[model samples]
Target: MAGTGGVRPSHSPTLPSQLGATFPARPAAAEIVRDLPWDDTPLGPRERWDPVVTATVDLVLSSPMPMAFSFGDSFVLIYNDAYADLIGTLHPAAMGRPAAEAFGESWLSPGLGGVIEEVYRSGRPFLEPETQLTVVRADGARPEQAFFTRGHSIVSDRRGRAAGVLTVAAETTQVTRRLQNLGELTSRLAVALTVDDVARVVLGYALTSFDVDHCVFAVDDGNMFRSVRRIRGEMLDEADERLPPVWKRLPDNPQAPLVAAARSGRASFVADGEPLREVASDRHERRIRALAVLPLRTASLSGALSIGYRTEHNWLPAEQALLNAAAQQVAQAAERARRFEAQHGTAQLLQRSMLPEHLPELERFRIAARYDVGVDGNAAGGDFYDAFRLADGRLAMVLGDVAGHDVRAAAVMGQVRAALRALALTDADPPGVLAGLDRLVGSLGAESRNEEIFVTVVYGVLDPHDGTITLASAGHPPPVLRRAGQGGEAPTAELVKIPPGAPLGLGGRWQTGVVRLEPGDSILLFSDGVVERRGRALNDGLDALVAVAAGAPSGDPRNLCAIATAAVPGPTDDDVAVLAVERAVALSRSDTMLVAAEPTGPSRVRQWMGTRLREWSVPEQVIGSAILCTSELTTNALLHAGTPAQVHIDLNAERLLVSVADTGTRGSVIRAHTDAMSSRGRGLSLIEELSDSWGTDPSVRGSTVWFELLIRSTSDSPAS
Candidate 1:
């Protein structure tokens, strides 16, 4: 009524000055109504108006809310000052006219006239929750988007029959817009993975949705509270770098507005200064005149969300309901993240504790291990490895896997690892140690009443003084042994010959095998995860491991461990554990090259390998043999794999072992060596005749071609 400006009617005479006293002081729209010539219209003079019509007019004019009364069959309009402002430019002229004629185009708006007619015909009240319309603002020249909640109540004449309709329309554009966009907010929150993510999403959404100057989202964290805030459009969080910054840390003042709201379990509005002063202690907080605090309530989480405006503003019922609904969404999202993080944290902690904190610091032998969990990282897994010095001064190493991926499996694995260490301390013998672990696992399975407790393990004891390892396996894959070459002999690699006893839970006999390790020798102990793949045979995975072990760099145990774990080429649903124990030796020279999947790759490998061999003082004859053999392998790899290949060469005093590995499926056809005369299988023929020993092995990742060459001794004459 106050800010709205109306258009003046054309050629309309003003009422007499003395007539002003006839009507009490009123709003602009009501003053115009009192002075209008009612006798000229369908309705008679004011004094002769029906008692029912007069009473209705008095009721509409006295109220402040937007209300318009349509009287009799013509449905003449009689509205209060608030209604005048709602009608914009049509105010004074529309005072005594029919609603349809006065409101013009707006009268037929979806929720306006249609609702009014329904009430008039049925003598019933009709309501439209929300509907869009075009209405010109008092200060604008053109109409703009507007929405309103229309309510039409039937008004009856003195005869107790349906007469006309009285409409009450409350402008709800802001409320409706906010409600409609809430779906977008829900979608964003659904993907939130952590507590901090929920905070960022909630705080950011609230700031923009309510058009507030500042907003904060705080969650209860036992004694302390974590919060994320957005101030003047800048978002701030406590901990975020590699991950999305969620709620970090904030002051947990007990009497703070947010704390009070969470504790009160409801919404609190602060529109007055005295209340704002009580909550506003900081410089920024003191500038806020209005605040709305809504509690984030869920079964498992307690928190609060707050929005503040710099100026005084009253929150309506619709707005309050929308804020509460948003708070509910925030609560649900927070609960999901909380549960996931809790389980993830527990799984990681339990698995780490089961493995050795840091590898046993040993000087005589180099030992390294690596463990990677499957996709279900939230589930504690059974894969584990440990290396520790035995009481007899020998080193004991173990890599094992229990069945399933859950807390129970992890618990069993932990017990088995602990038992192994304890038994090894009492007796460094490999068979005794594994025998003890078998009994422990069987007892645990019986106690837990789990029928699927299958455990596979490899226990080995390395003698530093003699460079010999005693190993025992219980339904586990045999360990890989990479032996350094002897006089004029090529180095060799194979799965150690050992007894494959039944799994621990089956209570099978345990036996041990002994292997003599030459200087510069390396042995790899791994879990079934190294070779167990879906839709493939166990022997296929095992054969792939031997190829990887033979081709990998043997000088460093850590490097070998990494290469072995990554041999899968792609994702796997099994956890992998690798432990490599090597006997350091002299006269070892190793070099590697990455050959691109192009025509010129074989030439580059030849040049690189020749230079490395010459630098090592390799005999010219030996260098020529290596260079020629490596070229054929590299060429075959590029032609068949269609992907980059890794050329790894290891040369010692007695021999050189070189391999070319590729990750590609196109090589399957080439691997078969079809068409003996077409140059496809020619490379294999040359390798077989020139090299001492050679083989081709294929794994899930791809395929590998390897060869060994023995250098001639100085005492031996050169080939004629």
Candidate 2:
């Protein structure tokens, strides 16, 4: 037969020809045509043997596996139809051809050719479970040896001599890949600890270790589902793509089938092709090709886990089992964190309600106060401010901070604030008030184990009448004072620092100090938390308060108090109380005027009467009479009105009059004291008598008897 490449086919068997030349022919058995002899007969016995040899070669080559033969330094491949299918149409008639001439340089390999030669020379069978090789076609494309397994055997002659080497191989490329996937899945499962960890591991495995377009995991937070982790291949950026809208539009009639299934404590698998075809109303039918939804349920809550693929692919039973186990681990961790957060929230609310409601009112003072709780986690601190009206009508203010931050500290603050208020009402002095408070706190401390909870307080009481404040401190910041001027000028403020003492509950002695507050002065009291911030010195904070208060207006204590509080940057982190008192002064006295005059002459009295009565718009006759009366009174005082005389005047809406008096060696003795007298005593009595009423404040220097005489307008001058 002629091959496609124009090579002549040889009828002679190369293996027998080489063996016949090396060894003698042997006899054959009677019935079994075994061990045929090798001889050089042109139409010889081997010539008859050639037909059987050809049939054997045809049987081996027709087998499904690819087979090849090599004899006497020449090679031939008799590939079956299955092997031909693997090679495609390039080498369809690959039989009885030299290994080198048929496959060319592709057949030149030391490892493969040496193995074939060893089998032929040793007459031994060999098997390679896996082998890799490359095949070159007539075209320019290179076909690389995707994996394969090979079986080799030595073909022998009738003389038991090695004839040729035969090889059979089967492709195993798919099996090797399944093993690699199994390895990756095992590694990922080992490290998944939490729900977030499981989601990340599974999503990464799908994208990197399997054939997946995109993978996502959504965890339920009560009403809605949120994507916790997502992964994708080169086809998509998982971070950039929004999840399928169907995820958002879960089954509204119930819950999403995925969510409902998870909540029901079951897992679900949705095949991309069949499920949608069966259920026409499925909203996610068009969005996803395939899905495996597993519900993550623990003792407390339930959520869903899903894997998605762009192409329709069946999820194996093993993959579903792996995902379900991962979801359970994640669910338990979320439940623990939720419980911890709830407990913390409750403790915070309890601490906030323990502070005082509002500051008490003061008669001549304005009070402003504010308290802020700390933000440090769940712990609650004890910072409080209180003001109350004492029994004496004085305003008592207290600001204190209990050491520590916890439920115990808050409880202690409540007790201490109540004790201070009761003590303040009983004791008039500030130091005495604090001393009583300390005694009460000490008595309470005897039963408690928390010896470290001490209270630092600044307490004070304001006396409205004297505009004085007595203050005492138990290692607390000194109160601030802001004073306003009478004419509404800019005000000045100062910190009224009293002697510091030990904190309450320390069983140490304490003392009180006094501060005299003038009218329009304010007192500011605050706990140390306001001034003692992390990185700032307490003095710096105090100085800052002083500066802000100094520039603040003295309009109303409330307004000034706000300004001062605002001056300290806060969330006070402490309690603050400011009590301001403005002393009220009576500026106008309308009923009486005090006057001291010397008698220069009767004209001097007349001039005094003209000037004083003219400013009042009195009639000329009344003015003249007033001057005559004053002249008579002064002349009498110089003679009878007495020496070193002082005149006193009284005015009202209805009447006006003046009285003059002088220092006398003898106090004026009026008979009947009301005028029933003779003219000599009557002149002195008439001047006293000239007034509506009179009285005397006698001194050693002189006796001042002042009287009021009604001045009549022409309308009502009854002749007396």
Candidate 3:
């Protein structure tokens, strides 16, 4: 024990404990204490160390617990390997430094160094159950939260005087963070108004808390159970990448772990894979070797959270308690979401029941309608549309919007729509229909003092025989007209100007406007939502709708309706409703085909066009030019747009017009000044040279390239 109590030379770096004197059972601990040069600090050399210091260092390093000792007035520090892990990056370098110096900014903030100093000065033991600390991991640059339950005890000198402090710490960072997140889970679940929302909040919390491979939240769905799951570091499908994880439904067999847990109303923990084989419902579940299924059971709802791992794991008591608490919150949220969905569904069903489920299908009158809900899908929207045949052999179409987004609004809309239909069946005209609807809304508004019922509507009557439509507007956006070109004129879409009447709630005189519907012409009636943006003027949206509808492939009612409804580019803050009706073009004189985006598509178009033209008795001279121009346009669409092209041709009494449309990112066709014979850029040049009047119109999805050819007369010249 020569180097044990006296100072040793620098060359002889080994301490007495290295030769099995003090730390005989732990050579690693002795080496850690022996490596540091004690002669440099206030604590002096190892050989000159006091007996109390020797005993204390032996106790600090040998213990399995995270223990550390700060000696004398300077509080020189020495700690064990367990303590090294607790401090993260503060280890090794902090071995023999003073506690205050080594602890840095955290010394005064966490009050650990001050507490230790007090313990050494007063020779009294102090214990703190919970204390917060910030740690920067050795492998990471970001600082993370940590907590500890530390106890400081006094270490006395041989003279019975207060000499140093001995500290023992238990890091509670994991459990503390999990508990904090659990609290956050409750707050987040409170706002979860739907089942998907609940699943999103619960699944995300479970995944982070357990450090498991995956987690799923399953809700009872009668004979089936719907589960929304998330896996660590997994790439989800684009369609499934949204708020509230997408759910997959499975059989509600009692043998399944999640199902069993929900039915048993208790928490189930599986320690091995063999027990899970029968319980797992799919390959994903079968991979889980260990599992914890916590049932979320309440008076109103029943569900289970399945937390799993690929490797076997033991669930701790603290973890079980936290998971159980989380399950309770999930159950409450599930109940709330179900209630909201139920009420929302009832309102939606009520409104849809009032509207015509199927439109009147007639050869001459082609109608299409679309109704879109607002951004908040939790509530039923007030927008509605209907197409029906009147007793007088006329097509009646109506598009209306009530001024709210709740059950009350939907109820008001249903009453107004139903009354209008009833009045129409009594042979009322467009003005009479509006007059009845306006009075009905006025009465409903007076009946309900809770909300002021306001509505806008455009109702129209189409006479298929005469090809005329009479429309009436009640504080609604005017109907747009898509007119098919006559002679050599190009097709165009413009708003049908009509005198506006006051909205339904405020009484005003209603009048009708007559629109002469030519063959292949479309009439579009839409709600204010289609033209009223959040910040922009109503005229801007109206202009955009006309442009979009005109550029649609043809005067097809379905295409026109879809194009007009999606004219606005942002989220729909209010409900959107649109209805379109187009007069049929002669089937024998018109043709439409979808050309695939492939190399052989142009050849297919050429062959098909030649056959159709010959069958229609078109002149050979015109047929040849039409085929070549159409083939060129189809080829351009395949090359530039990289999408399938919609090819449409209409032969009227005065002209033959052909159009090719595609949906690609780029839009609008600019005039190209290239050689007409060049192979690469000759598509447009060929179209301009051969056709009477050729142009391109850009649409929301892509562009339409069209050309008009003047025909001599309506004749039955040739039959191929």
Candidate 4:
């Protein structure tokens, strides 16, 4: 063949001898080239060929490499037999056509014609090996998009001038796609946070990218192997029950490929077996042909991950290594999740113990409480609430918050609550109780914590008989008292007139505030957690809480607490505690009984209590505690105070309050009586321990000694 110059080239004769010897006799592609109808194409006749064009053609035709000669400005395509198979269906018709017309649209791709143009203009050879370029090819029978690695160079004329570009290429689509998929799988595993997250990423990617039929991640649960996740193609399914629950200790069964892998802690391949097939659903058993399992090993445990194929697959070292890397990633992530779960459970247990086991009850009153820890905090927070009955037939509610969200702060809060409860029992005044709490916090906190701890609290004593609440605040939010309304009118929540004192741990005297209420009234006591947020003003949160309380059902104490806590708009950086009390009814004469205060007063009180409790169907444990506390109070008044004493027993659905009034000015005090022999000092000590609360009130005429017991339902009582 010759270029279309209408003259025989100088090297034309020598090229034809070489072409004739290689064609028809040596190469099938040369025969296809010789028989091509050049006159009908753009290159014209063989006699008109340029020496450089004909010489380049001879070289390309005789070469065994996959090479092509694209001649002239149009890049006329002329390729050898190796190159013919490389282009697949584009071959026979592509022999003498332009480069763009031969490869169709892909010839103009940046990786192809663009490189050729650069080689033609620069007159320099361009070489790129293993570089991917998408092209058309036939995989078995149908044409498909494929990848190739190609090298291009300038074809020089006899006169040493560039004429065209010659390219040598090789197909690499399968190898390239596999490497790319592996790279993506590794990237996805890097970002996985938990065991399930890693399993989802690796299993889903392997099924689709590696053309696998099934993937399973099984974790070791000591006694048995538990499948964390299993995927069949694109669908997620439960593990097959027929598979071995426990990995085999020995590889005695050659039929069990997954068991063998687990026993050996190495990757195993099975071309055909009932073990792998039996693990598949009945519908997919016939479709599965091969399986591969990789052992997952961590410092604490061992497991196996399996990948199944629909068609028989030859084992490759690279694929095995890829699966092993994935297994390691999953092992680390699973360990992380397990440790986090354990720590979370421990913190939850500690917080639960710090809260009240059960709220104390008062007659004609309902008590509800809630506590929420900060979402972002890792340790238990220092927010707590407690409710118990006082000596004067009143309910005492305490809500407190210690600064900081750590174990130390929680410990301080526990100490403060215990000390305050002890002080409140001996003293009748809320402000006096808080003042003693400040001194106790200063003394007890110094040894436990190096850093200064601050605590805020709202303590209220609610008299259900009179519907009056006396509140004391220690750098805490004022309690809201909601008055009941009539005629479909909603209740209104108002901040009580309490004087805010310095927070506990700082020495300052505090004052008490009083708020009078009616039956059906509700009082909400909360920590700053209910009203404090990051970007908002404190007053806004307080106002929002009031609104939520006002609109909430005053009759339901629990519902009121929920609404008030939820009123905070955003994340609460501190713990929140909401304690609410609703006055349901007023106490009447029927609720009270009197007994003459004498040496026999204690026994008489017990007899009356047992009878009343049996009639009301109160729990046996509550009745026992009530009778014991009443006896202690009556005995103390008879011994400590001079004669002319009287006993008043008050009963309500919530609690039992017993008061022993005497005409003596002698004040009852809590004195330590650890001695085994001393009897006199143990009276008030026993009253403080047995009763929920106890106190003494003095006047010009006499002083009254009182004690209270919390009522319990039958279900809340312990076995007698």
Candidate 5:
């Protein structure tokens, strides 16, 4: 088997026994290596003797790295004990087999089989960079990881022909995982912002990156460690049940290492039996075998971050470090959220204080008012109501709802309410008051039209003297009037329909309407909300109100107002304002004086007049008419050129008077029914009918027309 380079053929039967004995003999090696290239002559101990060949075989077999042997032109390879372990019981007797034949389909991966074949064909060393491969175990149930041999090569023959290939390799799973973890850590840290966000990220990363059963971060909020972030195999059911009651009772208990460590700005690690001792009575200890409590510290405060394990296991230093960083980041974020809530609370308080304290009193009127600013979790709303007396002894009242529900709206409400009071006191008409309010609102630089701010108002002036209420409505519901009477057996209620006017700032013609208030009458003024509820028509609400008012007990105006307000269901989403005015009862007629006078006449006539006055219930403070009429007639007959004369007197309920007359030369004095002049003829006539009533006797004087006047006194009337 020797080649042309003077190399003897080792595979031949004529080959020297000494050279054959130098190599460890595989059952087929003697025949297989017979065509080798190297000389087998004994060189010294350093050069290759039988001992050297034996040592080389020992070295390859005993090396810690996985080693394998491949014969010429074969896909299978024979592996030693170390290589067999890497293959995990796959082909336990894998010796003298081609690598592909040994692992079957697994060895068919690209580049692996090709490289091995090239090595055997060329009889040259071929280096395969660190390549990964999957090798099936003997059970064929799972695959084990292995790294392919780097730089596999073969021993060549004298003519550079293919012979056998050798490979060396090791596993690199642990190192690869470490690099991946580092990458994940960097990514998580980059996006962590707030405390909750950091806790969420850390817990999420631990669950996904480490493939743990569950990850939870219990944040110590001074008193208790609240489970803020939790990632688990199953959605957490009754997670709190997993926590020890003692931990909850003493959230900041100094004796508790987790809490103490966090509050003191220190990290505490508990594992296995140690955690059970501190939280022995805790029910959660049974489920959580290993626990690490890390203190999250910012400059001002410190809190605890806890990690739990369902199984007993030791936590690695890397895991602890990652958790500690995450906890610290979460602490800072918690502090920020707390500060924001505090500032917001302060703003809300200030806004609330700006609202009105109480409603004012108005004589002979009932007023109910409410201010609701519709601001939730924020500042106060901008709605207000006011009732006050004007300088003219009149009541001035106003209810206004601003456009917004924020602090800005509240401020604007205050300004608008104040302006309304000032303008109202100045006796400005309703439209004038609104115009002034608009001007003032417009002047508030920041609260100008750009803010789209406006207010709806109902302003009124009530004169108690005549029970007259002059009101100017600006985009407000017309005040309802419930006259004190029954619509049949039920009390009647009517929405006092009036001319509509534009709301403030809409800029239009505004007119005020006057309503005379009779005794026992009521006037209702309110914001739209009191009569308007969603899902219910406004008319329906009005009807309900009317029904309630009709059923309510009668009392003062205030009582009626209360009943009306209670009729509406809560909550009156917007502000509500009601003003009621009732006139006082009138004075009795007897309390007034009456004046009466009858013309002087005969005693008989005087007697008749007295009888009439007495029957009419007239007071005794007048001069009798009969005597006066008689004296006048006698004087006219004696003092002037006269013939016969006549006298008459009359009296009645409201007035009394008398008249005397004289006759002319004609047959009888003709009484004129429609003439302004006739001296002697009219003197008696003027006194006749103009007085109560008068007549003439035709004995000496002509006929005469006379009257009596009765005067009735004037006085105040009571409430009807």
Candidate 6:
């Protein structure tokens, strides 16, 4: 047969006669097979070879396609010139070795040896589109095992009985692995949430799928670059002292390969003997023969991806393109992480601002509050709580939750909370205040009308005189009341039995309930975040909270609040707010003063009120308002009632109460007095604005005009 175009093995004169003229002249693989020492193989010496085997070798050497013929039961391997290239550097040494000795267990794979056995048994040919094969490289490189698609056929003697197997195969490892790796890389990057996550994915795929010994991924921060190094599949600590200086130097360095790649926005290769100490550990640089640096650049983010090879290798266009595609994916993931970080930071700030700074302290009441943010990007939760004195001398406490944990929800919560506070001040009715809040939320604009804009609230008014709490629900969790047992009995905790109305902004009627809390009894109001879990039922969460709260000291509101919040189940993916109030027997009065019925009663009450307020260190603004309200009420008693006024002033732990009595009718009604110049009816209007609450009550002697001013914490900012 005529020889193919490539170099041919040299023909020796000692070659068998059958093959002497038939074999291609000077074929490279033929020389390797003919020169192989057959004494060491099952086939014995070349001269003692069977014609069947010798003919097969001649046929294989004449073929252009890579061919390997395994003859007899020992399956000795004799491959052609084309097959030597497929085996890499294992050629000459593997020429006449047994299949087991040359290819080892790799040749015995089900797809290869099983098919070869089938061909021999049937005396027929077996065709496989692709069969995997692994071969060691003569240079001993790690990526020696390659994959191939092959066909097997029986080689027969002149008698036509099958005696050996012939394989024709083509290597397809690089292209196949590239495709598989690309698919896996895409899938992993799709779910990556952080830059570190992207690095792990890229490094892991490269170590197992590409021709590299180590890899690194870095992110640029405008000022410098931060990086992570992974050798094979294991991650190296960033603080490891043995790492190369290049790993720590910023990517902006002019001489660094990674920086060069970033500057050029392309792939850069460091050839053999080039300085790679900048990019690898000292121990790594000793074995690193070449390096490939790829830049990962996006509009919002920039970084570098570098791979190191232990053996000198010229970068191929196909491999370079594959790496570039991977870099693009990593850049996209890094950009996403950056955006998430910015949004999360904004959420944190907004969430912190909406929470209360301190709780209001009262004479006979103990109050505690807490707010816990979720662990998600929308950390600014809609939960809120506030305790303040209303215009009717009652303590108002409210707990509410907006449906989401984002900026919009937070904004709505602020608006809704302010509206509730204002409404509670003017109207003492619990249900009426909730109804007004519902209307206010609906009026917040189109966005507030979204179904997701729902809000649940529990608003209550506590009367210190009788220890009665009037609560209204707007589709919120009911408040739990804990009653301390008398005579050393165990205390009991249970949810207040109240009608759960529709959530605010949903246009439904709200309902109110009143519960009398005895001395040492407490009430806990909370948002759903403190009780809700992913798989738990609403009732189950409520039960757990009740159990936790019941175990706490009945008189310690702060401890009970902490216990309830700490008992929330599972991950807190939403904001939580808890407000607890405990009622004591009576608030101790620090001082009291009375003015005898006389024409100078109003003047006398002013001096006493001013002195007591200043002594208590009340805010100057609050003291001025209290003094004015007391003077107006006392003057009305001595002038309109036509009788001497009896003025009384009392100060307690929570508030200062002032009362003026005169011999008169109870028909003095409060008028709007909208005109700025009107002076006659403005006294009551001034009292309405300055004091939290004021009203006229009939006494045995005459009518008493009483008002209360709240004593707030020094830390609390005055409400607008």
Per-candidate TM equals 0.47, 0.37, 0.65, 0.54, 0.36, 0.50
Query: Which of the two candidates, 3 or 6, achieves a greater TM-score against the reference?
Result: 3
* lDDT per residue as tens, model 4, 1-720: 111110111211110011111112233678877888788766678777778888878889998767888777888888887676555445566778876666555554444556676778898776555533223322233334455556677878787777778887656776677667767876776665444455566666667666777767666555545453344633222322211111112223434555556566878777665445544434565476777788777776666778877777876786777667767766676666555545654664576577776688655676767776676434788888888776766677799988888787788888888887787778858888888888877876687664377888888887766777888889988988787786557678878889879988688888888887677678888889889899899999989988877775333465566677788788887877888887764441224445443455567777987887677666677677777766665555554453445666555544555666766533222122111112233446556667665555432245566666655453543222
Tens digits of per-residue lDDT, candidate 3, 483-510, equal 9887757789999978888888677888
- lDDT (10s digit) by residue, model 1, range 383-452: 9888988777888888899988888889889988888888999987877777788788888778878767
Top-down TM-score ranking: 3, 4, 6, 1, 2, 5
Error of 5 at 438 (Å): 1.7
Off by over 4 Å in 2: 1-253, 256-262, 265-341, 361-368, 375-377, 448-451, 463-468, 482-493, 514-522, 548-720
Off by over 4 Å in 1: 1-181, 184-194, 207-212, 232-255, 271-289, 298-301, 310-316, 332-354, 363-381, 405-407, 442-451, 462-473, 476-501, 507-720
List, residue by residue over 459-571, the lDDT tens digit for candidate 6.
99999888899888999999889887777788889999888898887788977889988987899999888888898888888998888777754345655666788776688
lDDT of each: 0.71, 0.54, 0.72, 0.65, 0.51, 0.68
How many clashes would you count in candidate 3?
A: 3
**How do the candidates rank by lDDT, highest first?**
3, 1, 6, 4, 2, 5
Runs of candidate 6 exceeding 4 Å displacement: 1-47, 50-69, 72-163, 167-182, 203-214, 229-251, 278-289, 309-321, 343-353, 356-397, 403-408, 421-436, 442-453, 460-471, 479-502, 505-720
Candidate 4, position 50, lDDT: 76
TM-score of 6: 0.50
Better of 3 and 5 by lDDT: 3
For candidate 2, lDDT tens digit of each residue in 1-720?
A: 011111112211111011112212322111112222323212135345444345545655556555554544564444444444333333433344555565554344434455666666676777654643343322334454455666777766566665566666666654454445546655655554334444555566556644555455555555755444343533333421211111222332234555565667777786674333332233344455777767767676666666666677777776665566556644554454345445544554555456544456444444555444455335667777777788978878777888777788888888888777777767768777778878867876887865666888888777766867788889887877776555757777778868889988786677777887775566677667656666677788888888877775332444444455556675645533344444422221112222233334444556766776666565565555556556655544444332355554433322344556565532122222112211222234444434444333222234343444444453543221
Candidate 3: residue 195 Cα off by (Å): 2.9
lDDT of 5 by residue, 295-358 (tens): 7666655566666666776667866666666566566665654454455445445543554444
| Cα lDDT over the full model 1 | 0.71
> Top model by lDDT, which number?
3
